[model samples]
Target: MPALRALAAAVFLAHPAWADTATETAERAAADLREAIATLDQAEGARNRIAALTQTIRAYELGLTALREGLRSSAIREDEIRASFEAQRDTIGQLLAAMAAMEAAPGPLVLLHPDGPEAAARTGMILTSVQPALEAEAAKLRADLQEIARMRALQVSAHSALQEGLSAAQAARTALSQAVQDRTDLPQRFLEDPEELQALVANAETLEGFARGVARLQSDIGPPMEDFASAEGTLPLPVVGTLLRRAGEADAAGIVRPGMLIATRPAALVTTPWPATIRYRGPLLDYGNVMIVEPAAGYLLVLAGLATVYGETGDVLDAGAPVGLMGGDETALAQGAGAERPETLYIELRRDAEPIDPAPWFEQTREE
Candidate 1:
């Protein structure tokens, strides 16, 4: 009877260790997934801002350019040019001022008119004065209004884009949170099922699947669900940099393990776009800059540790457009190790969020 009791005790005691490890692993993976989603969200927000600003600037530039060209053919050349050109130029300055105001405003409100009613009223009066046959100032004002409308449309689209990204990010956060909870509950839930506990841990395929999903989520969105295999885009880096750590490796700061490591010239850039939707941009993290491209369902393009992030989210890009610049700072590059210089951008490819050697994918893409 004592021997039988001892055997039972040994079995029960060893069970908790395996459960703990599984829980820890799941929690770590969930956290990494959540962080990646959050980074994407940030990049999208930045892209929206850039788009709004760019659209506004372009509107102002076009209007001014037209007004200047019109002045060249004026019947009352000097007088009309002074009165009309100067006022329109002032309007251009005002528009820029409006941009600054929009920047300072909250959310996408930057797309709205920067000047309050007073500025609009003043501009209206100026337009009235400049509406002579000598210049088509009224037409120009109308064109400016239309330009603002186009910009506002873009901002509206961007707001929707934000909603989608936030949803995905929230999904990732929830998955991680649930995973942590699962870990915490495992001991009690499977207290009597030693076999079950062993089975779950041994299923490395489950872990691999989760990793693969992460990789897929990180891939770029092109033409609405372009499979990793069908999409013909590159890694978005213009310069060749040293490869850093592999996917699922611990980061130097030890904050959390990275999905992948990329080395680049201290300040090089890598760029990509928001996957599937034209409303958000890519470059979601700060551990340098990064871009994820989805060429097919099972593969992802990753470029990390960039110096600068260029290009707006939602903007369609060519296959090899420069997404961001790589870093060249010696102090920044020292984050890794000796003999193996850290001044290179790391490149990686993963299938369904799990890291796979990118070499084959690169070869395949190059051959095509």
Candidate 2:
């Protein structure tokens, strides 16, 4: 009887001990989304609207990522719980049938055991013992059913929250885009002539050649960003993403490039890591849309692979200024942020026309 009772208890509480951690993480993720929503609301009145919107968009991204992970854990846990029930289906059916048969029989009939009075008495005791175990298991089963319902509700609500966040973020993007366009307060380092840039672009055969041409075009760009050399290994990544490659590493196509690649979410915002003058901002050979900024006179930070580029050539931009967005369908993100990161940003740093490893400059995103 004890053996059977233990088995029933084990079957009833089949979820692994680790199940609560996932549930708690999911609850915390819900709280994070709530705070992100509040941040979005607070952004409306912030003095620096562009920076505010950038922060808000980032908050939503972090919240959504955590929630997505939570959802995945919840799904795995649910599958484990259901699988437990499925495995014990026969045992549960037998237990229920015995209980039903015992309930239907009269006391006298049950006492009339086929063997004898002594055997009948033993049978009565066993049935009485099983009663408590049966009740306990029934209660546990009810709890599990409730848990399944709760998970379903959580999933539905999480999806709803995701859609709302995505829509709000898109609105923030549009607002930020307009804000960058209307602003005229930024310092213009020098004037750019289209004819000159076109000629440079047409003549250049390699990135090194193109970059050298860009460096030579620098006019009296006032003063360069102060002490850019000292900022190495401490700079924030221009966008929120996971570092995919370091300089000299091979990429998906097995092509080695003197740049680092970062995997980013769809329509993810790209910002400047430091105050710098825009040397060039437009399409370049091989690379898609590109923005090359001069953090200092000889130091150029090149950001490539963008859907849309912002800011104009020779315009000085402060740190965290919106530079561009990674290419991806924004509407698809609303369905659910895909497990795969579809966008990639390529970053390269050069000093005095020599390629310097960009990894040393962006330690922040590297750790993440």
Candidate 3:
């Protein structure tokens, strides 16, 4: 199957399960991970190795994310089933005790009631009427037990696949970084003047000022990306993550910023949302490993909090090309340690000196 289709299917694998859905979900996740691993291995020979590796990483992420959610949901179901069993413990005990009584009675006397023949007949009638319901409950018990076992097996199997996928993704990232560096064929629109950029960064007081300064430094000989302005509200998010905060949304400290924040897994791939020229890429002020690119004459996109950056000043990047990877240990997400290794990417869109809400530009950013 195609990469995006695989990811879409994998992401939904963890949706609410019934009798056999959870097991099938785990099965699909495992298969998807294997496919992603295969893709990683084949990426080296692909013409566009960077794009291949990026897709591979995303495949692993979506599968693992779905698998994790499925695991959590399965656990809840297991707990509920156990609780249900526990809550009926007294009833179960009574049933067992009744069975023991029947077993202890002599075979010939089993159907006999000490009271009389009429009472014995009524007793037999009651037993006959209740047998089907009892059998049904017994069958349900068997099914629940089997489901619990299957879920446990699913978890056990997912762990090794998770670890393997994580390791492969890490290696892919390392290779991708090298590939981006080794690449020499990308077109350059203009080279940034180091001194001019340094002066701007040094004098800039806020993000808006820095973005404006970068825009002023851009002197691309080529025309801006055609129809870039018309591409509004159609661009996908540069990375896969949950929207942590919208543009101008306040943080925990009640501080509002122009950029939006996204919560991603460790070492998540960050790509260019559109074809753009790298205006500047490096640590500036407090933003760590920032990459500012101009997708149009007056529009600049700022991505910060990346662990490693790719491309150099003036190199033109195709839309969806890998720009960098989010910071954090890649294995941490699979180990259920994401809370301890939370990685967030800050994205800001600037039109000239004014900051604009990125949600209106990227459709995924508006997802609640």
Task: Output the better candidate (1/2) by TM-score.
Answer: 2
Per-prediction TM-score: 0.29, 0.79, 0.84
lDDT of model 1, residue 66: 31
lDDT of 2 by residue, 1-368 (tens): 56656666665566434446566687689779868977887786788887898888778877877887888887887887788789889887766775677688898987788899998898889878777877777776676777778788888888788778877788878887887788787788665655767799888687778877877774456765578888887898998788888889887899898888888888988888999878788888877888888888788898999888888987888887889988887566657655564699999898887888898788764443
What lDDT is obtained when candidate 3 is compared to the true structure? Answer: 0.76
lDDT (tens digit, per residue) of candidate 3 on 1-368: 13323332332232223655555666776777778877888886788888888888777777777777677777788897788668766665554555456457675574567988887777766655554444445456667788889888877887777777777887888888888989988988655546888888778676667887787774563786567898888898888888888887789999899899988877888999899888888777676788998888888899998888988888888888888888877666666553545689999998865788888788876544
Q: Write down the lDDT that model 2 would get.
A: 0.79
Best by TM-score: 3
**Clashes by residue pair, model 3:** none
What is residue 49's positional error in candidate 3, in angstroms? 1.3
Ranking the candidates on TM-score from highest down gives 3, 2, 1
> For candidate 1, lDDT tens digit of each residue in 94-143?
44454354346674342344687676565545433432311333344444
Q: Residue 119 CA error for candidate 1 (Å)?
A: 99
The stretch of ten residues in a row with the least summed lDDT in candidate 1 is 184-193
